[model samples]
Target: MAFECVSRTDVGLRRKVNEDSLLVRTERGLWAVADGMGGHEAGDVASAKVTEALMRLPVVYGLDSMIESAIVALQRVNQELIALAKGNAQRTIGSTVVGLGIMNGRYSCFWAGDSRAYRLRGDQLIQLTRDHSLVQDLVSAGMLDPAEAESHPNANIITRAVGVAEELKVDTVGGDVMPGDQFLLASDGLTRLVEAQELASTLSSNGPAEAADRLIETVLARGAPDNVSIIIAKAT
Candidate 1:
């Protein structure tokens, strides 16, 4: 199997600290990104804790095992964070997950909440994970148009997150991994500022490391409203 060329994370312009975490397993060619929710520092704790849990999962496995393991790990972190919040009383914490793990030349990804994964091949870019957010639900029900939903006052109100619920049902995507394929695993910060085509352009122009930098620069230039984390990798 070919390697995943690059993976990285950066704090965006507006946030005090990066509440995002990422991991890359060279052995399995896997990559992941998490966007944290909650205030009062709990968000950072939640994302870091969950990412550490996920990193423990074995790299050798089918997509199902990886996906299920991630869910279970996130569930455990959810319980831990909930317990921590009860003690603090002044804080509540949650996190969104988006990840990619590859095996036998196929890539599988899973997500919770709005953090997203995108696949860019040739001239097209496809978003693999759906956002588990109130606005997305409304869009699906045709209760709101996509453009209006983007700017809605409650647009940031996520309906589901990894550490918010007792159990997390992470959504999944599995597909072919062509040699030239480019994958993007990102926190909501980058997507909220840059569109799919723009992302595709960035991926096509540079290597994963440079692409990651460009992605952050784009968000910062646009005045990132939230903490951003980005991972851009290419099939070798």
Candidate 2:
């Protein structure tokens, strides 16, 4: 099996700096998206650090080994970020991460924070990772309605992130890969503007590269308020 992938990132209309980072190692079947927190200091540094760590992950032979290596790399990055933050008492930096790894006809989806992974199969779009955000928690607890969660003031407040604490918790899900399956890993910037249905349609109609471009264009048309990053992959 082989994968075709494409990625794109934009600073957006309002943000002065693009604090989003991504990795697209198609040869290694590894892809990731990191979105730096807007109010944090050195947000770009945090995101870039995580991506750099991921890029250095040793070549593992199996799915299990790859997953383990990914976890270890994230933990190492988290520790480094914590130490860096402690050195400066006035500010802190953190980023949300979402990644996809494919090996031996199987795939793994892992994440921390609101960045997400989605799967498109046979005209249906399904979200693979849940958000670790305040609004998500509220919605899950029935404190807020799903339709109202997006407009909530605290919607952007993620409950968990890479480099936000001494120890980082990563959520991972794995499954068998299918032919014609399309996977999308994106930062909140794109999700905040494009609906799932629209994403599905655009992805279904275009190739990986074109789909990525269209997605970015859609967000920009909506007055992108934050940095946007995305990775689109198709399995064959």
User: If scored against the real structure, what TM-score would every candidate get?
Assistant: 0.93, 0.98
Worst 10 residues of 1 by lDDT: 1-10
TM-score of 2: 0.98
Residues 41-127, candidate 1, lDDT per residue (tens digit)?
A: 568878888789888876546777777777787788878987887788845687888888887778888888899999999868999
Q: Residue 49 in model 1: shift from native, Å?
A: 0.6
lDDT of the structure predicted as candidate 2: 0.92
Per-residue lDDT tens digits for candidate 2, residues 1-236, read 88888889999999999999998899999999999888998889999998999999998799889888988999999888888888987356899999999988899998999999999987899999999999999999999999998899998899899988788999999898899999999999999889899999998999889999999999999999999999999997
In model 2, the runs with Cα more than 4 Å from the true position are: none
Whole-model Cα lDDT of every candidate shown, in order: 0.80, 0.92
Worst 10 residues of 2 by lDDT: 84-93
